[model samples]
Target chain A: MTNIITICRKELKSYFSSPIAYLLMAMFAFLFGFFFWNAVGYFVSMSFQAQMSGRTIPMDVNEMIIRPLLMNVSVIGLFLIPLIAMRLFAEEKRSGTIELLLTSPIHDMEIIVGKWLAATILYACLLGISALNILFLFAYGQPDWKPLLIGYLGLILQAGGLLAIGAFISTTTKNQIIAGAVTFGACLMLWVLEWVAGYETATWATVLSYMSVVRHFEPFSKGVIDTRDLVYFASVIFLGLFLTARSLESLRWRS
Target chain B: MIKVEGLTKRYDRTVAVNNISFEVEKGQIVGFLGPNGAGKTTTMRILTCFLPPSEGTASVAGFDVLQSPMDVKRHIGYLPENPPVYPEMEVEEYLTFVGRLKGIPKADLALRVREASEKCAVAEVSKKLISKLSKGYRQRVGLAQAIIHNPDVLILDEPTAGLDPKQIHETRDLIRSLAGAHTIILSTHILPEVEQTCDHVVIISKGRMVAKDSVQNLTSRLRGQEAVAVEVTGGDNAAIQQRLEQVAGVSRVVARDTRDGRHSYEVESLPGCNVRGDVARAVVESGWNLHELRAVALSLEDVFLELTGAGQAAEGEKQ
Candidate 1:
């Protein structure tokens, strides 16, 4: 356990030491801020229209502004998670530092989990940026914090699954660009996998939609946590990290 | 402290190390000498638990590498060919990180890092980023990382590869200082390095063992007889050669070119015999003018070329 934390701390420090952490954070906050403004502008205009029509009903701020804004944060994650996990293994292999970790008195599982935890924490930091944007909404309106916190929980699980996949892809190659591009391609595919359900109602189509990472988060976006979705994300995370361990095992044999 | 039996490694169809076996005794520095691509790095990697051998078995400090690699790793420190350092990390930071990874106790981590830096002569640059330092400093940082945990065994693959002459000397001295407390196996194609620092020599050629012995024994073992060079000035050249040949324990005398009436003779002595004393007495009793006399031994370079160059030919015909 100490080994894992040691590697984890080094991994996080390395991220901050380079410009990747700052660059990604800047890009994420910029894009999320744009999406936040759009979401709030649409909510204000809709309420004005209802008021002009003399309706007595007050609009729900949680549904109209925060929910979609947080959902858009997941869309930003599709672009950022790849960047977060690309260097986890690829940089080590490219720079030959993998030898240090491999020859040390640490297990392969510990190294894998340590790097995965670091990337997950970086992703959570990105979510925290979107959270700060949500805090602004709290200053002017009374939106229930419970639903926002639940949505953030779903975002964390969803990022965990995707980031794990990205980490696994990193072990297959030493080129960080190739790792990042392949991971981005993978994250984009998982996001669109459920789109097939719109055209076909077959059993395979339902399975495809069920496999879509975005579809499982639909309930969390509405402040409802389903056990089935939790299981799906957890299973994805397990499968991704398991495959990463297998890849690193083969790497030792071949290299 | 380390043993291997028929250890072999194959990447696809190419054999990197083939059926090579050798042993390293405790507190001794064994030089792993080979030509380029001669499986020296592969053998070291297997010993350090970086790669598993495709065949046979290797054990370090009584732990089989495959059966109990964690134990082997805990007891070994490795400096690979490339030095394996993160470019963005400060020298002190990198050493501390490696120390922690090697599981040095939290209390001793700082002192160990400082000790390693001082030993490797990188203390002056400890606060500098590794990428900002020169090649020599980077190599030393890699070395410091290896010894930070102070493992029982140290496996170094060309530890002085990128260093200047003075740094190489310092690194050799540092390695020598670590001898009694640490068993070290260092690989290099540099022959004099072995002559200067190593206690034993393990030579491999074309992925096969060529020779393994102490430096002194290996040189004499290759040449069945040791030669002593003598320059004599008083007697007839042929007569002096004959007189030297008649000395006790003398095998043969080959006379070199006479310069300024001084006859130079190479006196060969039979194996395990020191004819220096008897040769001097024979020359002195004869009242010959002895200008210079010294025992001449073959350098390790000649032995390496003779073994590896010949081994390649023998292996070529076998294939």
Candidate 2:
């Protein structure tokens, strides 16, 4: 446990020391805040509201403005997570530090878990900053804490799954650019699989659509946490992380 | 102590190290010498447990590399050809990370880091980022990391590869000081380094062991009878050569003359023969003015060339 935590702390320090983390965070925060303010103005302009009681606003109005903004933030996170996780092993291998780490006393599982947890933490920070929309809406209208919590859980789980996929892609090659591309390609395929499933007419296609990250996220966004949705997200995260571990194991022999 | 028997490593169809066997006693500083692409790095990697041999077995400090690799790794400190460094990290942070990775106890970690920094002469650069360090400083940091845990065995591949002459001398002195405490296997192409530092030498060529012996012994084995060149000013070249050849125990004599009118003869004799005095006496008796007489000593380069030739001849015979 100490080994894993040591590796995790070092990894986190590396992220902060690098410029990419700061650039990604600044871009994510600015874009999401700008889109949310624009969304608020658009939704209010479309409403036919006269000067009502100063203290009252429709509950659905805040949801209408905040949901699209937060959902867009989630979409942005899906792309940015790959950028952060791409260097986890790819850069290490390119620099030959993988040999140093693998020959050390630390277990392979500890190294894998440590790097994955670090990437997940960075993704959480990005998602956490975007969650400011919930607080922004609460300032003007009564907001449901239950739905917000559920949605945040879903975001974290989905980000964990995406980060594992990125980690797996990183182990496949030593080039960070190729790793980033492959990670983006993998995530983009899964994300678009649901849209592709929409065109099929069979029950299996509907099941495949249910496997999409979006389908599990819908229940959470509605403040309804179903056991089935929880199981689906958990399974994806587990399989992704398990594959990542296997990739690292194969990497020792490949090099 | 370390032992390797019938260890072989193959990449695809090309063998890198083939059935080579060697052992090192507890405090022997062994110099691993080979030409480029002679599998020194591969063997060191296998010893460090960074690589597993395709066939055969190896053990370090009584732990089998294939069975108890973690224990083997715990006992060995390895410095690869290129120092593995995270350039963004400061030297002190990198050393601390290495100490922890090597499983040094938390209480002793800081002290060990300091001791290793001082030992490798990297203390002054501890707070500087790795990217900002000079090549010599980076090499010192690499050595510091390798020894921070005070492992029983130290493996350094090309430790002085890119250093200036002064740094090379300092590193050699540091390595000499490390002797008798840690068994070190340092791979290098510099013959003089082995002559100056190592107690035993292992020479490899084309991924095969060519020779293993002490430096003095290796040179002694190749040392032939000493030859003296003598130039006589006023004697018939043939008669002088004939007289020198007739001297007891003188095996052969070849005489050559310059266009400017001086004759030089090379006299080769058997071991325990000092024919120089005999040649000078003969030249003076023959009423010839002996201009110059000098004896030549065999150098390590001659020994190296002889071994490389032997290795090549053996390779040719196998083909």
Best by lDDT: 1
Candidate 1 chain A minimal-lDDT segment of 10 residues: A124-133
lDDT per residue as tens, model 2, A148-209: 77777777877888888888889888899999988888877777768857689688888767
Segments in model 1 whose C-alpha atoms lie over 4 Å from true places: A56-58, B222-297, B310-319
Docking class of 2: medium
* Cα lDDT, all candidates: 0.91, 0.83
When summed lDDT is taken over every stretch of 10 residues in candidate 2 chain A, the lowest stretch is A50-59
Q: Which of the CAPRI classes, incorrect, acceptable, medium or high, describes model 1?
A: medium
Pick by DockQ: which candidate is best?
A: 1
lDDT of 1 by residue, B118-186 (tens): 988899999998999888888888888989999999999998887899989988998899898999999
Restricting to chain A, the TM-score for each candidate equals 0.98, 0.90
lDDT of 2 by residue, B9-119 (tens): 988888889888899999999999888898998888889888788998999999999899989989988888778888999999999998988999999999999999999
